[model samples]
Target: MSTTTQTAYLYKHAHPFLPRTIKAASGIWLTLENGQKILDATGGAAVTAIGHGDLRVKEAIIAQLDKVAYCHPGFYQTDIAQDLATFLVSTTHGRMARALLTGSGSEAVEAAMKLARQYFLEQSPPQKSRHHFIARQGSWHGCTIATLAMGDFKVRKAIFEPILPENVSRVSACNSYRGMREGETTEAYVARLAQELDDEFQRIGPDNVCAFIAEPISGSPLGCMPSVPGYFTAVKAICDRYGALLIFDEVMVGMGRTGTLHAWEQEDVVPDIQVIGKALGAGYIPISAVLANERVISAFKNGSKYFVHGQTYQSHPAACAAALQVQRIVQSDGLLDNVRNMGMYLEQSLRGRLAKHPHVGNIRGRGLFWGIEFVANKGTKAPLDPSLKVADRIHQKGMSEGYDIAIFQATGSAEGGWNGDHILLAPPYIVTKSDVDEITDRVCRVVEDVFTELQERGDIREVDSRVESRKTM
Candidate 1:
């Protein structure tokens, strides 16, 4: 299984390295065919909220399969699908009127975009001109062409720029780490970002906009960066003033990833359209959703009476069943409480171990999701050279035979979105104090070793990375 012959037929993302074969996985650990047990620190890109293998999730999937696995979504409405949708809507406490489930976050986001467009098209008097979208910088929604156009993830969407939609625009992201001015308070920063967004809306002609989309807590693009205080409140006000919808893409931070059912709950700003994924299935299956509030639902109800958007697998019974069971387990186990308690411990442990490290530029995130940024000069906060691939190096090293740990790597920050690096640690919700200690220790070792090797080679830290100087908004 480890030999090249086994992977000859597959095309991999990192073609230079063959992916490891997992013999089994359970409770935050992956056992390789060679009997190597790798610690899963980042929960497979922050998706495995519950853990590696749970009999409860397995039984749910099996139960659905036994009943029925595939049926035309257009022809029949399965009980499991209805139950899951109802469960999701209830989590919103009636704020969200309906849940449209899909196979992935990208699909849900695409649906949200279409739903926004249709919402305006179906309005009284029909505001047909309202089709533009204003998204924040350093944001990542999805991979589809339209979703790509709305995202500020520079590297992923650069080659497709010519094919992307022209109706999308960007405002400065609310990144306090690099975007905040030296003397500005949180209120000033929020106001500044709000003004920038308002100006973008005016620049685009307010009547032409459909929605302002953002992540409640930014995922990979900004490396788990949370919004500055009052940032979302101001943004929401601007969106309301323009009569445009507000979309919160919580694909990577929602569904108990951030110690709550929704990341927006902590912000106290309920979004009109909320897109969620990742932990929705807790790695038991692939499922995501677009939740629409009553305003949008009522508009569709009064007008078209049906969403124009549909997929062959829109309400797949098996997917719904799996996710329903996953959410149930999260609730039954009271995992959010664990996420809060363990998350605090994980933060304290990481800061204690790596805060003073010379190359560690920033440590930020909430709940179990934490990001550690690396830089050549901690004082200047200048990113490490993208050419060095510091994040990739650390991630690969962590996954290597001796290290046997997995951490999420991120890049694409700074001007032009090309010269920054960080690694994320999002251990499972079931992790305890001991697990946190182990994860923190392994992460610190991996980060320190990578930088140490670079330092010894006289290749980094001797000079500030030539990427660019920090520019404050």
Candidate 2:
């Protein structure tokens, strides 16, 4: 078969320009069909935790296939699924009592929304008025309609606004770098954000709010920004006072990506509901889950005892087996400790290399997850025009020869819905010191070269001047 013909049949994510064709992937590297090797940074949207090809996960899947692969989730119970649920619950240390396995992060988020609504419905007093959800301004929950409505990622949500639910509202994201004002202490910043949330609840009528949803560490939409100290505690307090559930979407940062097994562990507050994915199955299979706290679970148990939600592949045996083995490997190998140690090294390397760069506005993250936001003016933190596509250029440059690295790119942070760029780097947890060094060096080179090329062509000076003009005005 002809190469062009082979590529022509598959529908690509982007149009006019086809993505690189991967021949094979193994251990943090992807080999293209043309024999170019690309380092798998960002882990394909922070999904590949243990790396590309692990024999253990493959063997576990095979073993499950030998037993039974398919079963109706509503009719029969699978032991592998049960064990996987138990393992996930155990990680929460009794904070969460039940796990509803879903096909992807979007499904899990949808489930969380439904579960939150159901919990209120099942309550003794039946607060059916609680139908609204409050999410942060710069957030990316998922791509589905309901999840998109809950998220304020402008690029994806703007066109669908007319069709999306109006029940979701937004507040400022807890991004100290961009959201915090000058001369403001971290305590003051936290207090301000908390008050904004409280005011929002009051405006909406506390009884009308079903939950307040947020990512423990802001993901792509906010450039991997972690909240300031006491942020989560304050937000949780507001939710508690309003009789609303707190839902943490750990889909991108959970399951050992953030140096801890769960990102919430370091936040000093436990969520009433949690959505976990990506690293759970380690990119070996499609899997995600929504965990319900004891309070929410008990309400259902005492009332209807039915979730009213089920997917055809909800508890597929093979997926559960794959994820179970992935978790087992994470625990037995003590990868979380490695994540902590290597995370410090990665942060140090990034700061040392990019902190003083004119275009690099901020570098923030935890564990293996990090994001470098780009700006036209570092002092003013003015975002480059979205048309420049700074992050996308860096990502493309990294894939080119002499710098074969894969990094995640995102925009829409400078403003709530648009006008910012950032590159997210989330290497595999199995990365070593040498690996970190190489990845950092390659990423630094790509960022420098892309900006250098843009400057040589006078592309950036125009954007910077425009931003400066806007700021002065």
Candidate 3:
């Protein structure tokens, strides 16, 4: 296909300046129309856990299509949907009771928010104080108006601020690298962040809060940063004290991306409601789901009214069938084990290569989901100017070098709302050791090339000067 045709035919995620037109994809590689082979290092925003072009997933989808492709959940529930729900609940130790599927992660988040509000109505007092949702400053739930307003990133919400919803309060995120005070212990930092959450609830009036939503492992906004130990335990305790539900947005970090079936599994905290997507179906088909435990389900079961929200395409048969097979493959192949092994190698490779880079201020993540934070100076921990768009430049360079990596950037995580830039690297769970090595090598080269190009263009001083400054500190 011609470049113009490819760009126009597809509602491209971004503009076509850096054209990445793919003719086909298989086994972690995409072939462009120009015959360039691009290694999918980030798995298209960490969605491809089983790698590209899986025969089993394709077969499942085909089989589902033969039976039914589009059946409204309101009118009929297919057997495939029921089977997928059973599989998902079984994977969670049968603790989860009900499943509500959606077309994407954002819809799942919206459902969770709505369900949390509905659950409050079923309470003995039928609390009306549960209107505000307290989310962290650097947390990302989804792109819906409710989710966007709950997040700390200002750029995405700037254009639609007038139409965005109100009543979502922001608090300091559980990012020790950014929010923790100097000389603070891990436990102290956890307590401090939890206290800040509680304070927000108090300021909003405890009775007016519905839930505290967060990602178990930070995605995009704070660069895949996981909370310090005991952080979630403290947060859960505070939420219970205030009668607010705790919602975990595991859309990016869950589904074996973090060496476990769920990122919250590693944290030892159970959420009242959990939102999962992306790798849930491994990108064979679009699917997302929200799981409610017995407590949350009981509220709905005992309530007089029906759960008041749903999508026409909720639990699409083909999507659920593909997801069922995708999840089964993850278990049968022991891919979570692979993620553990490969994640260690990936982490080592990243620290080994970029640990000393002048701009790489922090390298934090768990399992296969990693992020590298960039900075203008190490001593003051100041970010590069937002106008530079350093992350965007690196992404383009990396793509030109035949690697598909997503650049997750956010300003405001460092000092305020416009001072941070970081790129997230969440490779598929099925990535091999060789893939890990190549990813690190390509990333290091891209970082080097971009800095050199910037210096040549007189964008900044010597690149190594920042590295040297970091060493002295």
Per-model lDDT: 0.88, 0.91, 0.83
Q: What is the lDDT of residue 331 in candidate 1?
A: 96
What's the TM-score of every candidate structure? 0.96, 0.96, 0.93
The candidate maximizing lDDT is: 2
Q: Tell me the number of clashing residue pairs for each predicted model.
A: 0, 0, 4
For all predictions, the C-alpha RMSD in Å is 2.7, 2.7, 4.4
lDDT by residue (tens digit), candidate 2, 111-198:
9999999999998879999999999999999999999999878877776778999999989999888888989999999999999999
The TM-score that candidate 1 achieves is: 0.96
Q: How does residue 115 of candidate 1 score in lDDT?
A: 95
Q: Any runs in candidate 2 off by more than 4 Å, and if so which?
A: 1-17, 462-473
Q: In model 1, how large is the Cα lDDT of residue 98?
A: 95
lDDT score of residue 65 within candidate 1 = 97
Looking at candidate 3, the ten consecutive residues that score lowest on lDDT are: 464-473
The local lDDT score (0 to 100) that residue 389 gets in candidate 3 is 78
Over 439-469, each residue of candidate 3 has an lDDT whose tens digit, in order, gives 8888888888888887788775323332432
Where is the poorest 10-residue window by lDDT in model 1?
Answer: 464-473
Return the candidate ranking by lDDT, descending: 2, 1, 3
